[model samples]
Target: MRRNWIIAEFTYDDLIAVYIVDVSQVRGNLKQIDNSRLDVTYEYYPNDVDVFIFQYSVDLFMSDGFPILERPILNKLYERKSLYSRSGYGRVANQVYFMVEFPYRKCGLLSYLNPREEQLFQRWGAKEIHLTAAWDGKVIWRRFGYQPPEDEFAILGLRYQHWATIHGIEYQEPQNINDFPEEFLKDDCVKLITMYKVLEECI
Candidate 1:
């Protein structure tokens, strides 16, 4: 099928937004800005325009009792040139791989996020930003544009900015994103986490 993604870019005041779809509640006619549908596979649209304008993320699964990776921890360090956000759509769709981005400083009243991070997200044309304060290992898909499975969860597209513009209006300060996971804090996993932002988006 010849598919085309309806994309729009604008400043925060321009009212740009991300389309966050409830994957568990997709029905049909996703052509509308607020409308959404179930997750689709690559083979479903062989002749479609592979247009990924910004970053995106989704939760996923490997197998029964198989451990899912905390990829975002590493993925986040590459903030600007990368994509970040999570959706429970992966496991529901029976797949692996997700996306991740650095966490913005917590909001206080009405002006959260570091000016530098915000500028970076904006410069990358992300327009939208979404993330939960806490991590839910039982859930929470990684954040990035990974190959999608056949299912979807909550989808936040270009419309995410709208949510931020309205609700995330609060003061924010720099937050120290722990490079290492708690499992490694005591040197159990013994993995090292030394990260820095990458200038290149695609590898």
Candidate 2:
């Protein structure tokens, strides 16, 4: 599939802005610019054959045009560049692995990015999204409908028990990801577990 850059406009927190979907194709070097509002840039890196690394950074400004925060908020590494099917076989699926770092959690950035990400997935014909949820991501990604595999859940249960023991808290064997306590997600004792979300008929 040919790679094409996309431009999109978004309105969030009463702020309106336009951002490029793939900035690397256009900007070869980072240059300082005046921050009039929220500025977002997406970058694409071809890491290997059929694998790509994608990232987006944000420069946030207040309603009064005061710069608040500027940092990279999301990174995704994915494989299988396009949809393909072998003779007598069904369409093959691929996965996009991602990590997020949002300094301002309440800024509604994730809400703005989720749909755009789904669009990207559709373009790549990816059927699953995966991540290693740690720290706040454990709860955040769970809320976003990502779930750990059963085997990983069992391992998480063991880690949860150990964490509870160390904190002198009552331990209840977690039946699922939701069974884990919210407090445990905020701590470093819990092991980072693989979580995945299966997309519905992206094609």
Q: What are the lDDT scores of the predictions, listed in order?
A: 0.25, 0.54
| Clash count of each predicted structure | 23, 0
Best by lDDT: 2
TM-score, per-candidate, Cα-based: 0.18, 0.58
What is the RMSD of candidate 2?
A: 9.2
Residue range with the least summed lDDT across 10 consecutive positions in model 1:
104-113
TM-score, structure 1 vs. true: 0.18
Off by over 4 Å in 2: 1-38, 42-44, 48-58, 64-70, 81-104, 166-170, 191-193
**Model 1 Cα shift for residue 39 (angstroms):** 32
Model 1: lDDT of residue 59: 28
